[model samples]
Every structure is written in structure tokens, then in C-alpha cells.
Target: MVFKTPLLDKPAPGWKQDLPGPNESPSIEPYPPVLSNPPNHVDNVYLELARATVRTRGVGVWLTFLMFSLAIVALLSLIAYILKEGTMPPPIPGIALLMGFIAALWGGVFIWRMDVDPPRDEPIRFNRFRRKVYVYRFHHHGLRPFSRTAWGVRAEVYDWDNLRAEACSVYGPMGSGGLIETVTLAVVKPGTHQVIDRFHFAHEIQQGEMYWAMAQLFMQQGPQALPAFPRPPRDWNNEDVSFNLARRLAPKVQWPAEIDLESRTAS
Candidate 1:
């Protein structure tokens, strides 16, 4: 049975030629066991329940916040010192005031750009037995203070068979790393190539293919056929002290009870 996506009904456009092109992927489904790298960014995998889940990759939100936080604190402290002292130290008083004002403005911009109330991670669940996939997507406009649009989670379910893989190449900042890429799984309309909705799958191109292959293998032959993951299944609650601290600030994963129950159990 094909489960309908809750997000959209229209065909997802913007895939014109020369933009995220190469129409189809060679690593599409019925993928063989030739893939290497077992799985990456996976938070949990249940062999018994035939379920595996992974979060969005490369989101080092904690580090980013830390860097910005320290800078903001320093800038504020400097501004406070200037205000308290009421004396000019380096350049002219006007120049010092101007510099302090600029620093304050930069600090405010940093706060605006920082992801303050982010959902810990965007988790995507694959239920092999049910031949279904669930995405816990957190939608936000920008940081809370600057953004007028409220942020929230948008969960969706899809039939595993209707999904197709699209390898999207991304250029690095200053075009540093040549051929940097990721995999985006497009949900086609039942039997047609028309895309209805999509979600990111993996980070690296080769590893993404391997990860998709692992998903295919698990969905087809169960977890027994899959190789062991390099790292053990992550326990979010008992993660590293630093990550746990970061998690405290981010919103918890609140999957719908019905979807959560259905995804983890064979009905």
C-alpha cells in the first residue's frame, strides 16, 4: 500500500537541466551488496523490528553555537568595559565609540544567524518490513529573533518502492573541494518519474550510494544480510557529555505516536 506524503501534492519543480542534473542515478534500488561503508549518521538500528534511522549529516550545531557564543560574550564584555570606564584608550573617543558600535552590530548579526532553537536533528526512519519510510523534518525560517515565520516539524510517510535516488553534487565554499556531493531521495508519483517530495539521504557521494545500498539490502533481505556498522547505535540520552549538553538546548525528537509505533513494529 502506498502511504501518502503529508507535505505536498504538486510535482516538486526546480530540477531543470544543468541544475542538479544527471536525470537519474546509477545507484538506484534493487542495489546489490557491492556497497562498502555500512552506514553513517545513523542514530539507531533495530534488527528485530526491522527499522533503522539516521539524522542529517554534517550539522555540528553545537560547535557553531559555541564559536559564536564566545565571540558574542567577548564583544559584550568589551562594550561593557568601555561603558564603565568612560575613558578613551586607543584611538579618538569618536573612533572608539564607532568601533564599539560596529562590534555590537556584528554581534547582533551573529545572534541572528545562529540556530538558536533547532530541533536536535532531522531523523529519517526506514522500516524494511513495512516497506515504508518516515521523515521527521524540522522546518524553520531562520533564527527565532529575526524570523517572523514560526518553525515546526513536518513528518511524512512514503512507500519505499516509489523512492528513487538522485546524486546531487555540491560545490564547496570558494569551490574548494572538487566534486563534493550528497544523495537526495526523490519520492516519485507511484509509477511515474514525476517527483512529489524529496529528502536528503547521505553526505558523501560514494558513501551515500553505499548507505542506500545498505537500506535496499535491509529492506530486501533483512539486517542479517548487512555488514556490521563501524560505530554502535547511538544512545542520544547517554551520548558524550558535550553532545548531551547540546541536545539539552535543541528540541527533542517527538515522533508521532502512531507513526513511531507503526514504523517499529510489523503489523
Candidate 2:
């Protein structure tokens, strides 16, 4: 028997022509969180924000630690009882000790995992004076004594001039019967439009303002001039808009060319 590949549908010759031109504008509609009522947090000074996931994870870590601590305490009590009660079997103490050890080991592993796999949605800090952006992730262990150093915090820095920003809309079905819209901010490499970081804001009151505030800082453009959500040329894909904006706004950096075969041979 011979195997054959299935044919795929092909676009018409005029498909490109049929698409809306760059100049054409779609029915741009403005959604909630009006420009007038920007979030109070949108100030000219340094800005710090964290994704919702990070907050949720922090709560989860504390809860896990509490549960583990209780288990450890109960195991220790069991071991003590086994030792004092002469009526109990000889192996009771040993079994309790073994279980306690296992619980302790589990607790250690949990702390290690939390430290190494810190939440992805860490806080983002933008310092205007320093011209830098910093993202911070925190790790904590309940067993260890509390100390600032023991927080296991880590930070990553990005230069202000090298950063690019993009906004995209996400839609999903809501249980209430209507669709819910979410806005996402993407920090990207200038010119190339490669995404380095991203975060989301629920598309509700005040969130839009927060997005614009950050975008203004990243673009180094005035807040008024920053691109608004549901950007123009609605026919274009969000990815296309992001790339085009990056190319237009970012300074074009000329990368060094690859060495030729002749140069390699001579070397």
C-alpha cells in the first residue's frame, strides 16, 4: 500500500488584496474603565505591580507550611506517647520515629521546591531615576528563622531604553452569560518584537489606566499619546500590531554580521 499526504486548502490569488489595507480603520469601539478615571496608583514616580497568580501562590505556600507543621507536631506527640506507655508494643516507638522522619523529610522537600520554583508572577518594579526595570520573586521556608536574607528573593533587571511594550485583548466566556475581556501587557525586545516578559490585567474599571500608565513609561511617550486598547486597523492581528509598533518606536540596532567561510578559513 502507498501512503499519501492530504491536500490543504489554498488561499485565492486576491486574498491579500481583499484584506484591509494598513490605512483602513475598523469600527473601533471604546470599552469600560474610561480615560477620566485612571487608577489612583498611576503616578509619575516608580511603579511596582504583581500578577494575581503571585499573590495566590504566596497564600498557598503559607497554608502548606501550616499543614506540614501540624503533621510534624502530631508525629512528635505520638513518638512521646509510645516511649512513656509501657503497655504499647516495643516497635511502636521505632515506627513513630520513622514516620516523623518521613514527615520531616517531606517538609524539607516542600520548602526546597518553594524556594527554587518561586512564583512566576513576581512583582515588577520600574525605577525612572535609575532607568531600570526590576522583577522580583520571593521564596520562604517556615522551618528556618525569619530573616530578610532567608526570604530567598531573586531579581532580574532590564534597561529602560532597550524595552518595548505591547497590549493585546483576550476574550473568554463568562459564567454570567457574556464574554469577559482581559488586557495583557507584553515587554519585548526593541525592533525584533521578541517578548521578554508579560502580565495581564482584568479588563475592568481602573485596569485600563494601569496599563496605559506602564505603557507610557516603557514607550517613553506621554500618557496621552500611548496606544489605547482595541487599537486601530482592527482587521490586523494583535501580533502584527505589536511587531509594527515595536519596529516604529524602538531604535534600530544593527547586529554584527556572521563571519564568512573565507574569514573562518583564514583564522
Q: Judged by lDDT, which candidate is best?
A: 1
Best by TM-score: 1
Worst 10 residues of 1 by lDDT: 14-23
Per-residue CA lDDT of candidate 1, range 38-154, in tens? 342332342221111223322444455555666566566657767988853456654655565555555544333334354555567677667787777655543343453566577
Question: How many steric overlaps does candidate 1 have?
Answer: 0
* Model 2 agreement with the true structure over 1-267: per-residue lDDT tens digits: 111321112221111111111112211222323432222222344544443222122333455566577667767776676678744435766676567766665674564345334443344555554555554534455555334466554555666554432222334454645534343344456654455665443243245334434444433532343334332222111223242322223222121233111111212
TM for every model, in the order presented, reads 0.58, 0.35
